[model samples]
Target: MELLPTTIVAGPSLLTRASALDQVVGKLRAGKVYRREDLAYVSNAVDRHLREMVSGGALKRLAQGLYYAPKKSVYGTLPPDDQELLATFLRDKDFLVFSLSSYNTLGLGTSQLYNKTLVYNHKRHGIFSFGNRQFDCRVKPRFPKTLTPEFLLVDMVNNLDELAEDRNLVLQMVVRKLPGFDQAKLKRAVSNYGSAATRKSFARWQDG
Candidate 1:
């Protein structure tokens, strides 16, 4: 007589899956962002646990493979920190974040208030939104670790077309303001960060 073959089971059983999910959830800290792979070691079924937690509001998916653990305050749940989100998304700490309102500090008479936030990073390019917040990420070949007066001026000209000011008036002000900035540092910033059009324009400003 032929003996019957025993069937083999493939993945974790429901009880084991539940235990793994419990372990994964136990590791969460509020107001922190996580990459999917970050919790993989804690769960045999990380994707399933993530899906279940997302469905149950234990996690908020910020992007593909990205999640946020919301923190509660007296008012309501707080959104993930911008720095933390960018750090997780880019997987790099080399980035510069600033608002368009920073142009006003340049003293070129630009006072427009903008709600937009710009992120200069070497890794990603495009707009990403988290809840009510939006980050406009631009991939730059080179950017300063910190914002500088000279870098801001070059950046302002590079993005002049996008600003809400009169282009000609701003150009005039920029030309006049050139004399006010450190000639050497401003030239270096323009050489390093300026767009072709900005470089040409600054060349004329410097020559004249």
Candidate 2:
């Protein structure tokens, strides 16, 4: 019976891991969203810290590698801020988030509403689910920092057929409404932001 020396490999202690978790959680902005990399500056063991936090009810896992500290309400946990999540996902502050429902504001003979939100950016393109909402990331060559009425109008026309309302009637109404917009700005938007088909469509309306 021989007992060789028992070897214990020393790694970070549970206390150290707990401290890393605390540091990571403490640095997160409540009601805001974060990604694993966003918290990497605080702890290299981010995945473990996040997993423990989620298990402890200190954080909510929104999606793969996405998390929120949550804002409490009598109703339930409020969803993470979409703007911050999208910003983190894209890793750039240069993107536009607009509700597809804004198309209803065009007064194009339909108050039809949609549940999806549009994310305009050059970095990513796809449909993603965030919290309780659906976000459609559209990659564009150029997009304005802030949406303008002229841009909305052009975008509505560009996506007209996809809308639920009477496409022809909405198209006709929008064509008529075009006359009411500032001619210069409308033309510029069509030229810069509008697709080739959109430009052709606008030209047809302008001529007739």
Candidate 3:
């Protein structure tokens, strides 16, 4: 009788997984946000690693499949940066995030402090909550990569109805301030990003 040699096939060891988990955690940076899918290439068992990390407080789940590596400040834990948070959430870098309060900086005679933060993107449309902050996502056909005074002026007029200030008063102020802006840039911004009502209002204002 001939004895057949047996070849042993061993599965991955517990140590191997632990090491991989460590590698996964090591790649995360404080104050950054991530989606589980973003780390899939980092480890074979990313979901399991993420679960364990979340349980161990090494990572915080911001939303479904979203994680944050929180940073600590003198005050307390710092939230993820808005750019990073949105970049991870939408899985796209082409988006604009701004607070309605930013309109006040345009010197348009608007003094209201708006708590709302609006995100304009092509991917997602609707509100989303991440930790304690909420972002209102609006899908727009066109938006600038960076905010500009011209864009803000057009956007404010577009969203005039949603503003808390007296719409008529604000519009009056916008009209009065129109002469101060570069006509070419203002017209281009209005043509590109303004709503139908906004376009008509701006056209009438420019004509006058």
Candidate 4:
């Protein structure tokens, strides 16, 4: 068989690129999410190096400046689910809280494991993917620092069914888990919800 040129034969420096790829993958495997700025801190060569590794199947791009290492499937295809990627991205962005808080606070519903994630943002709904599961962004109009935490707790309760299977279990768990939960605060937060279901849920939490 005819041989290609040495450059084409090597297809770029696999060994050197592999090392760079390993470093990136290591960070991700450690449960760390990275933005472009974070990668820039690692090396000036990150952009080109990352792109090369992505092309070489050493890395999977979640979105711009977000990535994950794919696990091998039975068929040998590397796949990472969307929720995993979004969680990584949210971890990096620092704008997300698990959806369980809502279920717990409102006595709404229950899930064996938490799947849905609530992300706080004012401008746009940030939705993106990593591998299989879908991620959704729900937008809020304004988030004041003082009220934001409470709002997060309240929003989760109001949308409890989005994350759980048994609403009563969720409520019981919240009441059991949260320390020093202010009944006044919970009542005030639920007041923001005019929905009868939310009010009823709040009553259940209070009675619990």
Q: lDDT per residue, candidate 2, 89-155, as tens digits?
A: 8888899898768877766667867877899998989998865677899999887888788898888
Give me the runs in candidate 1 sitting further than 4 Å from their true place. 1-15
Q: In model 3, where do residues sit more than 4 Å from their true spots?
A: 1-17
Which residue pairs collide in model 2, if any?
Answer: none
**Which pairs clash in model 1?**
none
lDDT of 4 at 62: 60
TM-score per candidate, in order? 0.86, 0.87, 0.87, 0.45
| Candidate 4: tens digits of C-alpha lDDT, residues 148-189 | 435555665566666536667656766675445665665666
| Model 1 lDDT tens row, 23-125 | 8898999989999999787777788889999998989998789999989999999888888989988999999999988989999999999999999999999
Model 1 lDDT on a 0 to 1 scale: 0.91
- Candidate 1, position 98, lDDT: 96
Output the worst ten-in-a-row residue range by lDDT, candidate 3: 9-18
Better of 1 and 4 by TM-score: 1
- C-alpha local distance difference test of each model: 0.91, 0.83, 0.90, 0.56
Clash number by candidate, in order? 0, 0, 0, 13
lDDT of residue 75 for candidate 1: 93
> Could you give me the TM-score of model 1 versus the true structure?
0.86
lDDT of 3 by residue, 1-208 (tens): 9999999865679678778889988998888898888889897988788899989888999999899998999999888999989988998999999988999999978888977899999999998999889999999999998999999999998888888899889988998899999889999999999999989999899998
| RMSD after Cα superposition, model 3 | 6.7
Model 3 residue 74 lDDT score: 100
